[model samples]
Target chain A: MMVSLARKTLLHEWRRFLPAMLAVSFATLLQLLQAALVLGIFGGAAVYVSDSNADLWVGYPGTQSVDQGRPIDGDIASLLEMNPQIESVEPFYLLDGDWRGGHGTGGVSVFVSGVSTRPGAMMFARVLTPALRARLAYPESVIVDPADLNKLGVQVGDTASVNGHLVRVVGTARGLRALGGADIVTSLQTARMLDPAPSDSGGPTYLVARLRHPAAASSVVADINGHSGFGRYQAWTAPAFARLSVLFWLFNTGAGAGVLFLAVIVFVVGAIITSQALMAAVAASVNEYATLNALGVGKRSLRWVVLEQAFWVGACGVVLASVLAALLIWLAHSNNVPVAMQPSVAAACLGLVMALVAVSGLMAMRSMQRADPATLLR
Target chain B: MPYSNTVIDPNPMLVAENLTKSFTSGQLSTRVLDDLSVEIGAGALTLISGPSGCGKSTLLSILSGLQAPDHGRVLALSESLQAMDAKRVEAFRLHHTGFVFQGFNLFPALTAREQVQLPLQYMRLSAQEITRRADEALAEMGMAHRQHLRPAALSGGEKQRVAIARALAKAPALLFADEPTSALDAANGQIVIDLLHRIARNHGTTVLCVSHDPRLISHADRVLTMEDGRILDDSDRGAR
Candidate 1:
């Protein structure tokens, strides 16, 4: 009987709910886009952190994010390896550099990391392209990110210069998008040759160390920094540094805050539009509700009718919203717009629509309780 | 019809004692019913005839449990109407009291059969039971052929008969008709009055009709005449 009643209400009063459904669908699509932006930011952060397989990062003290890493001297790297608690220490250079690929119409700056060929820290991000490895992989070859394909206008056989060092771009792999802009992977030998004062440049901007045992991080840092000569360096755990870097990217500017504020506005407007539609339906059926009450229908049953109508409106709104959200998300993704279609975002949008329905149901209840049965006779 | 089912204990179907009803219009108060007392017995047709402004409709409303009198009591099957709670009165009215309005209160959207079925919705009857009851009521009112017709398709008099069928669909203990004949012409009014008599005799249902028409007085088993909210004369069939 309740189901039949719902069908009658939805069938008869579609105009009352269509606006609300459309509003919710729009909100859902925007929410998906917002989620995609959030996902891309976080996904990119994970890739950047994992690419560096260093167990411990020893940088300047009080550094919240790796983007804010302060430079330390090469003397600290030298004195740190002398400690008995340290298993191994390798100095690595990290910086952002621009590339002119395919005649450099739109210049794309990429993050460059200098690495040693020996098996040590920061080996996980090593680009493994066989063709490039056999040719100029040692000091003459460089790997560019896939993201720079259009911006840099480079192909597989393009040659690019880095800091006055004429280098050939042999292979195209993953790990794009830099702190300022896409990564241009360069060898430590090539980077040192381009950097002229490489020896005096503080023995790699960061000295990464692997703990002999996982639990010995604090003791190792303590033993190394306790030496009077290495007082300038700061040692941080991997998880801590990764978390700091993500926080820096997320909260560094007001970009995330602006998106959240816009999302809230959309949600509020959607809820209002939905409630107005439901309220209009209730008002139109006011006389019928009174007639039903006069026919000796219980207040609980009348209340149930209002709630069931609300359920129908919400259900229709959610279905329409889901389809529209999917379409919009697909359109954005195909157009190369960053939109993460995560399950949580879908669930949240659904929950929001249902919540609007519940609030409108509550509004309809007042009519049910207050409608005088005698009014129909009048 | 079985006598046992139609006549329950042979008591009066409705009793009113010293009934007084007043209405507050704007700032002033007026007495519509003043200590009115009456009894409508089973298997008999009782008519209350009065001129305009005689409180005929008000008395009917009080009798049908639609309105409460200010300082009097009403009873149905010896059950006091004034003392019972509002919900109980409403339930009793729904269960045992059927009302036919002068305006022919048929839902415009419903067909004749559906109109009759409206009064039976509160009852826990099976689909077959409801349909059978609706058909029987319409047939008794001589509206069997018009079962599928909407109120818009029916004449003014035919609409009143449909209203009667809807009221009788519940087989209520007492049928209250407020100016049932006022909305019909002389010939149609006679047909409605004859149907009331047949139902009273054949079904043993009590009939209490409120009307101002002198033509309706001839068919009544008993007539109570009122003037200016006062009963001026009470007479039987010969004195009618």
Candidate 2:
């Protein structure tokens, strides 16, 4: 009966409560999209290092993120080979260049990652599926993500000029969505050839290190970090590098702070609207609450009723918000917007809305407690 | 002092001793009840009638455990209403007392049946028993036909009847009514008064009502009249 009282009150005042429900729904939508935007940017920042088939990453000492890496001596691969825990090292070459597609697309900024194709030695190249991997082996061949299809306006078998060098489109890959416009994957020689450098200018920008035992990556990283005269190069366990990359975008840049500020604004606005709506509903029924108190209903029971009402309104709002958020996410996805919605992100958003509901319910309960049963005598 | 209405029952259902209550606002204080004592017997319809603000309602509130006195104590069913904490007072009211209000304070969203069943739900009765008691209470109040109607859909008299049913559904040992018929017409008020009489006579429930309506005077077994926060007259004793 205590539980049903809340349900009954909500059902009784649903018309008046609709505003609260809608407020909660709108709040949920804001919370989800805001979280997704931040998570998407974070994901984009770390994708390059995370999708690699390496247990550790070797980069320049000041490289706060993978994208900020500077060129290192390619001979470090031979030195790292001496480690007992070392498995294989793949030198990775990354460059940014303008691309001209044969399919009438204008110049667009694109990033290229060069991967070693030596048998069992291409760690970064493992990101491509087997078919794309085989197709990328051809000379002057490159692979792009499916999202790049519309931007590059070139598909499989099409030709694209990267920095004035014509490269054939071999195949496409997944999870390679780019942060800085578009990305392409090609063999090491082709990638180096496109940007011919001084013959003595060391090696690739970074090294992808596979470990014999993945758990020993920290020890390997420590050993590499301790190596003398390695010249500005830093080694990291893969997870650490990924976290660093995410943190670089999140704190090192103003974009993360801007997104975080907007999310806070959205959360506060939604919470205020929801709390006010609930408070008004409770205020209107305060007389009935006093009568209940006079009838000997416990304070806890009355408190439960208000809380249950808030929960019902919040739950309804979440369901509605989920639908709206899904449609918005789908539209953004189709438009190639980088709003990522992971299951964990959605769960977090839901948890935030529930917290809002609980706070509002408790606030309303404070007002309910002031209801004097003596009012019934009047 | 103890004022008698007929022979005072040796075993009283409720007793008040020098109960005094006052209200203050913005540096002004008015004594609502001034050291007045009263006793209510079991199984009788006791009416406290007086002009507005004469403290009849205040006395009812104190005696029923709805409010505490400023300087006195109330003993009901061998328990101290003044000494109990708020939670215990609420529990005592839930198990031993019931109330019918002048406003017919029905939840607008609940059907008449639901309004009556609200009190019984807290009693830990089986669902069937709750339904049975609710239905019987509504039937006794002549509200059976309109049990499914919400308060908004019910007439003034029907709403009052539903409130009465809500109070009576718990089968309380002591029932307190505050101007229960104030909002109804003469005929409807008479109907409600008849119901109160029936409840006291048939169910052995102590019914204490505070009202200004003189029509209630003839039906009450004992009528206590008040003036300036003091009992001015007891009909059985002919004087205070």
TM-score of each prediction: 0.67, 0.88
Candidate 1 backbone collisions, by pair: A36-A340, A110-A182, A177-A182, A178-A181
DockQ of 2: 0.57
lDDT of 1 at B99: 67
lDDT of 1 by residue, A50-94 (tens): 566666778777866765555578677666677666677776666
lDDT of 1 at B137: 93
How well does each candidate reproduce the native contacts, as fnat?
A: 0.09, 0.71
Model 1 chain A lowest lDDT segment of ten: A1-10
Per-residue CA lDDT of model 2 for A217-308, tens digit only, reads 88889988898765668898888998888878888677778866876776677667777877787677777778888888887888877788
Worst 10 residues of 2 chain B by lDDT: B1-10
User: lDDT per residue, candidate 2, B1-240, as tens digits?
Assistant: 222233335688899999888999989999999999988887678899999989998899999898889998999998999789988999999988888889887887789999988878877888888999999999999889999999889999999889988899998989999998889999999999889877876787888999999988887878899998999997753123
For candidate 2, the docking band is medium
lDDT of 1 at A365: 72
> DockQ for all models, in order?
0.16, 0.57
Docking class of 1: incorrect
